[model samples]
Target: MTRTATSAHPLDVALELEPVGDGTVTGRTTAAYANMVGPFGGITAATMLSAALRHPERLGDPVSLTVNFAGPVADGPFTIDARPTRTNNSTQHWTIEMTQDGVVATTATAVFALRRDSWTSTEVAPPAAPGAESVEPTPGPEFIRWMSNYDMRFVDGGLTDIDGERGDSTTTLWIRDNPARALDFPGLTAMCDSFYPRVFLRRGQMCPAGTVSLTIYFHVDADTLSEQGDDAVLATARAQHFGRSYFDQSAELWGRGGALLATSHQVMYFKV
Candidate 1:
């Protein structure tokens, strides 16, 4: 079946949650984004963020978010709680949790703030590359269903080998929703986690892997976000350290005209 069969975009469907009363909501896992062991971590992260976004008490846009995966989220229904831990004149803090069968599965914290005009500058330069159109789009591995949801045109460090050569785990790509949905905060949050595990690119092989914790810092204010439409964003990621069991991944997402949208950091578990 096509992703639009339900009329709602696949992402909206993936992030869908139902009101269960008392300021909580319930959601279910979708086959569209199923991973090897559970649902895609990005979708889960976005869902938890959605909890905060959907709350009526929410203030301003998101500035930062951190999701901790405590356990695998089995395919089924799960509950989420978004509580405003603290709120100030210009900022708000939140604590969110996801649970299945009354057992905690995921936990997250987020901060939202009303942005004001101020001096702005980007200390880092964007990577030099041709526009996204000039590059050829690569098909996602069929095994990972969620990858197909994106139109990914990689500039370098693609998943073209499994046992080839070991090298730096850096990937630069232009990406957007496959069907071209309009850009939004939750959508941007989802895209931040869309890259392949850095370990795969560095080791030139696939291993049992998953994100342990994912964090995103949004540099976008309301004006900047409104300027971003459906255009593909330039994204780049690399691994800073690979230890015996875990590796660290850092990434940046840039909108058109070198607009630094967000920067993210994540840790992943790996076993050779």
Candidate 2:
């Protein structure tokens, strides 16, 4: 099967991966993924992880995953290399690194669970779900420019400026898997890294200062693309902290009827 790259929004284009000899590969990204932090913000460590894991032969089965952001990223084609840490009948461990313009930009390590094994169940109730039609999507080319990977639709109060005097430090968004290509766990994780700012906009903050790290948890894998055809993926984010030059952020994902889907957290660096 041919692997297709997935985007978080329309402007977020997934650059095709090419071989660079050895155990390395290169991929390009559209400027939309750069965020307001110039051509180097929000490009995330997981983005590199996605590129590294794009090869499914390394993953035993899709399950739970965690990524640690080691550093910053820049615009243009990036390179990634994956090394297997361990592989068992039920799980796989990996160490991945991302390079931009021949410079090491970020590194990550992850644990991916497999589906073909017996395991104990340890599921917990997710956080509260927000109103489906109350939270809205950001509008205009400036905001829209940041979201070019996935297809998005407004459900509430967006399309205005995020100049700090808006609503609260919280907002919800409905995001779907980009149908332009076939997506997998890493792709979804990469997209998860892209969903934010609804909480920041309420504080009238523009441009990301910097992120110390980003983490995501997958409660259920969104394997089938069509599964989300009729269901809307709700993403709710909160600004944990806004300090002199950095911010702590976290977000949760829910299904149409409020099922806990996934959760994400990150430390971001601003442009101020």
lDDT of 1 by residue, 64-172 (tens): 9999999999999999999999999999999999999999999999999998889989998888879988988898879889888889998878767445757778899
Lowest-lDDT window of 10 residues in candidate 1?
1-10
Q: How far off is residue 152 in model 1, in Å? A: 0.5
Cα lDDT, model 1, residue 95? 97
Q: Highest TM-score, which number?
A: 1
TM-score of decoy 2:
0.71
List lDDT for all candidates, in order. 0.89, 0.57
Q: Estimate each model's TM-score.
A: 0.95, 0.71
C-alpha RMSD (angstroms) for model 2: 5.2
Candidate 2, residue 14: the lDDT equals 54
RMSD to truth, every model: 2.3, 5.2
